[model samples]
Target: MYTLLSGLWKYMFQKDEYCVLILGLDNAGKTTFLEQTKTKFSRNYKGMNLSKITTTVGLNIGTIDVGSARLMFWDLGGQEELQSLWDKYYAESHGVIYVIDSTDEERLSESKIAFEKMITSEVLEGVPLLVLANKQDIETCLSVGDIKTAFSDCAPKIGKRDCLVQPCSALTGNGFRLSTEWLEWLLTVLGSNGISCVM
Candidate 1:
């Protein structure tokens, strides 16, 4: 089940809606980002506390405001048990954010496989993909070029289907705005083209 951390969710939504799915390997900080978003919603995030927050079960839904659009964000757990549920939201996501722990070199091969399988699926074949090369503040993370090489085949071919390989740090808020803005622009463009998607 999903929970809302803010009371302003409903009143804030506009007709131009978009859903962004955040997927990555286990311990990729997907859940932490959502919790930080909750703290941002509460407007009291000075140094932010993460003690009571729990790892996402299978999926969690959160909301964010980007430009004039209300973005519905789904944070998906990347565990073996949840692999089957990936496609369930594939068709729903207009944009995707794939996170990776920058220092985890051992999992690079595994990440490439997960990305390939997800992109090759009939449902996620054409949506815009954002590679959040997360945890960049630390050393030993793969370069953005490295990830692009990993998923070269999955890059978008046209208007709303293109993929952007953006490196970001979920812990320090770096590149977060870019992630939101990219999604906002892509959503606006897609909506104008009559692509009706659900999140």
Candidate 2:
């Protein structure tokens, strides 16, 4: 039984990664959100993606551990056309994150579209969703109520969707800790019940 014991030890030492998909309209600060997350728990993770423009064609993958589980954050393309291809990844996603460019009043409609597509997609149902209404530092951001109303208008909450709208400013690192804190809490709850999350 040496082989069996060795295999069990290997599995026990291995860390499981939960896939968290982050999506938003172009310039919604998704890449920045990830960079900040890395910087938070890690000793010194410099978030340079903040200054660069991102056009995510495939996917931007980032990993951070909550307790024992490594979270894989997927920073999806915010470009209008690329977003059309996002449905394929939903099947592989463990959770959904809708990042909003709160400064872009005109693009709020697009966020509605993305959130709608995710809620309606057959593979994404029942997954917990967190909507980061980002760019709160900007003067032109829509209020949290407005963003929530937008989602409520789409008719998902009434149907049993786990969602939260948090006003965040990734540029200044304003509300990131709150969001990640919730993430840790959620993972803890799920893990306690044996959700296969690696600690």
Candidate 3:
């Protein structure tokens, strides 16, 4: 009877947890986006100073609870050497958020290359993907359509998984609502499909 009551209590109160990865090139604002997301979603979280945030050399982690779902974000370093480590976490992640520095036109191709490699990995197959075209607060950043066009060739590699390229400014918190909503929606879909995201 005690075991049954404990199980019932946990079932009623435990939140379903999911892991999401934030990947991008160096200086693409992956850490900034993670900070903003935590600040916006976690009521008591007062995130760090965005400007003072440095390039992540290893990994930065943050957690936020939305409704009954808890999302654990892994913000990995984007340096070439660090990218090799990304796949080590791919098998465990439920989704991926790839941030692109829209204002850095010179690195667009490079970013696309990394993105293509990430999506093609067999371990990440069927994982939901969110491509954030960040730095939209800059007057000259590329638009969502522009980024999409640049990555159009990779669509076949993306397959039928849930994917979205959203315009956002990590510094200004633009597009966070849509991003989080999509994650919440993923929880619903995964639940219906009997997929377990708990780790």
Candidate 4:
């Protein structure tokens, strides 16, 4: 009777869970973005000091509840060696958030290469993609249009997925709310259709 009651309680209250990946080159502010996201969405979550955050060496996990859905974010390390392990989590991910350091003009091409490789994977086909141009608070950072233009060649590889390149600053939390709202709306729509994954 106790077990039955517990199960019933959970089933009635549990939010639909979705896995999201936060991918980008090292120093692209993936961890910072995750922290800011958590701080913003979870009312009682006092996130880490953004300034003290360092490059992710392995993986950082965070969860945020939006409406009836819970988004579980996998913030992976972006170092060259660590990037090889990203695909290991691709099979279970519901969406992908590819972050780019807009201020790093020299590495923009490198970032594009990594993004192209990730999006073209069969496992991630049709998964919703959110491209964040981080560090938008900087005066000289590349605009969203510039990044979109730089990534134009790879658009065909992205297929028919719901993809957007948004300008954001993880440090200042600019554009963060809008991005999460987009995810919430997308997830709600997909959930209503009885689909767990975007495909």
Cα lDDT of all candidates, in order?
Answer: 0.69, 0.74, 0.87, 0.87
Tens digits of per-residue lDDT, candidate 2, 90-180, equal 8777777788887787877877887777778878766777778898887877888887776777764325646566788877788556546
RMSD (CA, Å), each prediction: 6.8, 2.7, 1.7, 2.8
User: Between the candidate structures 2 and 3, which one is better when assessed by TM-score?
Assistant: 3
Ranking by TM-score: 3, 4, 2, 1
Off by over 4 Å in 3: 175-193
Model 3 C-alpha lDDT per residue in residues 1-199, reported as the tens digit of each score? 9999999988998888888899999999999888988888889998898999998999999998877888899999999899999999998888889999999999999999999999999999888888888998899988889999999999999997877777888888766464566566667655564545765
Candidate 1 clashes between residue pairs 3 or more apart in a chain or in different chains: 102-141, 156-162
Q: Model 2, which residues run further than 4 Å from truth?
A: 155-158, 176-180, 189-199
Clashes of each: 2, 4, 0, 0
Tell me which residue pairs clash in candidate 3: none
The prediction achieving the highest TM-score against the true structure is 3
User: Number of clashing pairs, model 4?
Assistant: 0
Greater TM-score among 2 and 4 belongs to: 4
- Give Cα distance to truth, residue 178, candidate 2, Å: 4.7
How does candidate 2 fare on TM-score?
0.85
Q: What is the TM-score of each candidate against the true structure?
A: 0.74, 0.85, 0.93, 0.90
Q: How would you encode candidate 1's per-residue C-alpha lDDT over 1-199 as one tens digit per residue?
A: 1336343564365346778788988888887776666556434445346555566678888775545565678998888678678889887777777787767878877877777678777776567666777777676777777766765665543235665566776776665574456555556655664554433
